[model samples]
Target: MTYTHASPEHGAPERADDVDDVARILQPDGTRVSDPALDRWISDLPPHELRALHRDMVLTRRLDTEGVALQRQGQLALWAPCRGQEAVQVATAHALAAGDLVFPSYREHGVLLARGARPADFVLAWRGEEHSAYDHAALGVAPVQIIIGAQALHATGWAMGAQRDRSTDVAVAYFGDGATSQGDVNEAMVFASSFRAPVVFVCSNNQWAISEPVTVQARHPIAGRAPGFGIPSMRVDGNDALACLAAMRWALDHARRGEGPAFIEAVTYRLGPHTTSDDPTRYRDADEVERWSRRDPLARLEAYLRDAGVLDDSGLAEVARAADAFAAEVRAACIGAVTRDPASVFDHVYAEPHAPLERQRAEYVDYLDGFSR
Candidate 1:
């Protein structure tokens, strides 16, 4: 029932050929490892908070499962599973302050869940009902960006604005390893470096990007790319919840103290396909998936908590019941969802009405009237 995760020994170089150049604080078998450098960030976390972390991961997995099911059952257009990246998403979100902002790629369901996204918020866009169901300013999370790596620039720009106003808020961008290869991601790093903006670039280096493996994107560690941009970066075992929490805390502290942006390459695996539209069997080996499954983020954290006396059999059952209830709520919300008026698509295309846009809207209305005739 415990995990035996591979934790790198100390003194490994940051830029290396393999993922061994990573930091970890928990072993796969539920044993706690020591990392003097990173321990301070999470040393004071109370038992209740630790238990909460476990619950968050559990709920996130359930949400992911329900989302995939919804898509399969025809309630959603598509879904992106976070089967193995729960620890990274939940831990990083917990590290954020109320004023901090999140700019996430479309797959960051756990992050949005941790940030209090409602079930309807999660399904609105996937159901083709709205641009984004959640309120961006209110949640402090920007609308999901389907365009790969674009959120990096958005986060950097938001950070720059915060800097100009002398606000203490920081912004974090979440993207996959494939996004690191995109021009927008590279350009965002350049601007963030030049301006010393208070932003954190978090790359969940889930080994595959659609049909391509991580090897196709970078010969070296993704963490290595940030230092060249004059930013400090770290690679952490993404399956280790404690390690991820510690790493994010350190990065957030660095940004909050007026230092330049930092980067985190959370070495994780994509246990599922890239999205509901993808098929891993086409390019991924079954044995490889089996290997990564042994390092399941939820199981790893559950083992750790059980050993630490923070969770028992009853506690585990309670968490499961909560997850089931949450999933059911999400399902009901999606099933009962209502679509918006077709004309509403043009409502927010511009901040104010324009003559040409109004004309286009009128034309569209006339086109719709043709159906009646």
Candidate 2:
């Protein structure tokens, strides 16, 4: 689905009134807000488009589940599950233009998938076979940054480039709430505001950074921090696909109109371990998981569709079949990816060859040859 550039006359100005309007539409109790503009926006979306969002959430959830299984089976070194956070990734990425660049944290497999990165490509990364599985220039996606908040710097730099070229394309940086404490993240905000860079800083505030709860990071809401950096910010119900889509649309529009960077804090839960290597049960309560399960993105969207008569039992069964088939394919690719060469570690180190690296590469090859004998 594509979004057109919204003119000032097309929608209400994003002020206190609009914020209140959006908050009403996204109330947690499923009450419908009375607004012609909001109703029209929701009603204008075709059933197929809504179903597509459902499919993306289902497929990405399945991918995260299978990835966990692969790690358990010793096929991957590690895996980060975006289990309950699918809406933040899928809806936000879907709201972007083809020309926009995405700076992803390592856990944003769903974003990569939405940006057209194949399942095999993502598998290769977790299999520890490649730092990045695709050409960033080709995909308009940066390599997944493992160092928390580092991608913010790269995203800000890319935004600067877009501004210099007078391009309308925006850049999006995906990071967790934990990254907010990082110096690089703060620096990126400074640069983005100072230059009024066309970018969106998307914080998937899943409420944890590994074992730490978000309360340890900030006493107030994380979105409130954006205004201090001279950027407008909003909080969206990350479990609600429609809310995420709307918030992302607003952020992207703000960027495209030369209004400078906007911040989106998607309030969601990470219903799984930080990674396959970590056991969340030790740190978090099972009751907490059960609670968030009630607010599951897939279930919420499915309920919305069923209520609207957009999806039925038979349709859900078909989606299940497709999800299963896709998961099987991903599993097969991930298993194969595990056996690939551990070489090529020296290939992309530098644009110009380094003498020390060359020597080390020769020695490594000789050591491997010795094993053959």
lDDT of 2: 0.81
**Tens digit per residue, CA lDDT, model 1, 1-373:** 0111222454443333265556889877768989876789898999999988888899999999999999999999999998999999999999999999999999998899889888788898999999888998888999999999999999999999999999989999999999999999999999999999999999999988788878776766888778889889888899899999999999989888899799998999889888999988989889989988988888888888888888999999999999999999999999998877788889989899999999999999999999999
Candidate 2 regions with alpha-carbon error over 4 angstroms: 1-43, 338-341, 351-356, 370-373
- Stretches of candidate 1 off by over 4 Å are 1-17
Worst 10 residues of 1 by lDDT: 1-10
Q: Over the stretch 189-211, how does candidate 2's per-residue lDDT look in tens digits?
A: 99999999998999988888899
The positional error of residue 155 in candidate 2, measured at the CA in angstroms, is 0.4
Alpha-carbon local distance difference test for all models: 0.88, 0.81
- TM per candidate: 0.95, 0.89
Could you tell me the lDDT of residue 96 within candidate 1? 92
